[model samples]
Target: MQMNEEKDSPAARTVAALVARARAAQQVAEGYDQQRVDELVAAAGWAIMEPARNRALAELAVADTGIGNVDDKVRKNHRKTLGLLRDLQGARSVGVIHEDADKGITEIARPVGVVCAVTPSTNPAATPANKIINALKGSNAVIVAPSPKGWSTCAQLIAHIHAQFDRIGAPRDLVQCLPAPVDKASTHELMRQCDLVVATGSQANVRAAYTCGTPAFGVGAGNVASIVDETADAELAAERIVLSKTFDNATSCSSENSLVAVASAAEPLLAALCARGAWLLGAARKAELAQLMWPEGRLSPAVIGQSATRIAEKMAAREGAGRPEWQAIATARPSMLIVEEDDFGEDHPYSGEKLSPVIALYRVADFAQAADTVRQLYAYQGAGHSVGLHSARPERALALGLRLPVSRVILNQPHCIATGGSFDNGLPFSLSMGCGTWGGNNFSDNLNYRHYLNVTRVSQPIPEQVPSEREIFGSFFDKYGTA
Candidate 1:
């Protein structure tokens, strides 16, 4: 005999329905073998990577969210998908995945039930697509909660994935997202009911996930910084910095927010940055920008993810019709904005991340001071994220890597592109970056399909090797004599 179900509110009812469908989908997915799962993931990835469809998706993402650029987004989506496929080619994630005959143990990969991914406005399409691919690859169903601004783009992405799923006779409900009006109440309900949550937006959202009484993975805000030592090539450093800070209007959280230049190299760096079409703001202009961008001690969203010229127009103090110069810069659209500031402390608002084509300039006495200044900036916001260092001395670079709290130290590479994953580097390709405990995250690397799977260890009886106290502490005993 069945019992009567209790009446529920709209939010609870919606979440319950979605989770129920997802559970059913996951149960079917779990029956798939490793090869079948990989084939499905590959099919979805290829469909999304189709040249015409991928380009259209990029344009749609930018038009809907008003963040990032179409060209970059296209490149990001294709390349990230390709990289993930590369990483997944031979990996086993179903049934018995590993065996260690020497240790008489075997490891099995298991699905983590249903997962909920919280996506942000920037990279909305890419992030959701990647998360869906990952969840399905691990034989887990996923439900995304896209930012309100990104709902349309995410919906389109999900539909395309569903098209692929249908071709393979897979359940459509395997990938679900809160339909529209993605609000606080609905999102909270969804997170509460999901088996696991991959939260990758604002700090508040990440915190809420932690409190939802479910296992979660979250990333943090970025205030990434870089150092220019005396041995660095000012021209190359300036070129890379300007390109990175201005890429997609700096919507990437990994974009450089500050540049600590050794005193001897500061002038050359400024000249190099200027040569790259960066609008250098004098002291007065810098102060004006500060007041406008941070009117009440909080960064103004109006200037964020905007072109350089748009930013300058906001900083313009005159109340009358804007001067021709403002419009000229607007029409020309400088690559980025450069401002000089001596302060590197939290009190200095310029030292923090600005999600725009802006980079704060700081002068230091030497390389050691530069390293210390980088540490101080991370201590303010970016800790466990990453840092960029330019130097000819390997020892100096290694020393800073040892001293800083960051998980990655990009040496002579573009901070923005290199932060997540680069072909030149060994890190996994991902849009979601974990900040570790420094930024209230559990991981210090990129988030990928591997993060969504659970592992089971099977152990068999084996000869145990228990060492005696003297055997374990032989070196210490040899040094100090037995007590």
Candidate 2:
């Protein structure tokens, strides 16, 4: 009786209907050849990349979600989709992908079936579009479960996708979203019913995806701390960091949350940042900003992803205290605010991901101290996501990659654009960045086409070429006298 009741619930029924259509669509997709799959992927990409349609989606995302501006969203929709399509140009996801005579094995690619993608409000259009493209490239169906604020944008994007699918004679149901009443219950049901879940949003959603009784891929929190060492060109480093830190009001999880500058370069780097319209808050102003941002022990929604001017306005209009001394500060019209701090962890709120046009500045004695500071920052939050290094010396960048618990070490570029694949860099173009074991994620690389499919290896009998015990442990025996 309980099982029947559970199945008949409204959330369950909604999810069942969506999943039924998706599974049917995926069954048909299973027969498509690589060329057909590629065509479908192209259709999906075009649906989002078309300039007028992209503009509409971006505007709707900003108007509905109030997380980012339309201009940046428009650029993001174009570049991210274009980059992903470029990455998928010659990639194969169907039929035999590998054959090795020496190993007597053949590897064939297979679809992962219907996918449930839970996307965040910050990236209503781009995130879902990327997931849909990847799913179609693998000949799978995708159903997006967008956040409440992102529902309208996602619905419109899916409508465009369906129209494109109609033109291409593909199944319209192959890409869909949870309709009107998008609640947690509906998303939970969708996650439970799908073959796999790819969640990119709040840690709560990622955790739920992991526990949803399905194979899942989810990203982690980002508190990216970039190092500006003595060897770095201070002007260039400041220019790139400011550009990244202020993009889309810092909605990206890959955006820099903090900066650790070596003492020798700190002055010049800070001066460059100030010249680029970054305001350095005084000690009292920093405390006020912190209170305004985290009044109830959590980041207040009013300033979470708002622009620096908006945040400044909020700071100036403190509740009962009529126009505090910061009124003149607010008039500066800064592009971003800089808060210098020496501590980290829960008690120090600035140490974690800010998700806005704000940067915490830390000064260290040298490169070694900067590295140690980064390690401590990770210990507080954002382990295994990524870090940025601005230095003339390539060895310093390499050392950070080897020493820190991070997935990508972005070198001499804007951390946000470089962490997720860039045209100039080799990282896969993606919005979802898995932070590995350190951040409780399954992957340590950027999410890409390869994560959307499964591969089967067929082994044939071959002459064994086993190594002798002496050959396997020769050095071990010589040094430690193995038993």
What are the lDDT scores of the predictions, listed in order?
A: 0.84, 0.93
In terms of lDDT, the best-performing candidate is 2
TM-score of each: 0.94, 0.98
User: Candidate 2 residues 251-318, lDDT tens each?
Assistant: 99999999999999999999999999998988878888888888999988888679998888887888
Name the regions of candidate 2 deviating beyond 4 angstroms.
Answer: 1-4, 320-325
Flag regions of model 1 displaced more than 4 Å. Answer: 1-7, 316-332
List all candidate RMSDs to the true structure.
Answer: 2.9, 1.3
Q: Which residue pairs in candidate 2 have backbone atoms (N, alpha carbon, C) closer than 3 angstroms, thus clashing?
A: none
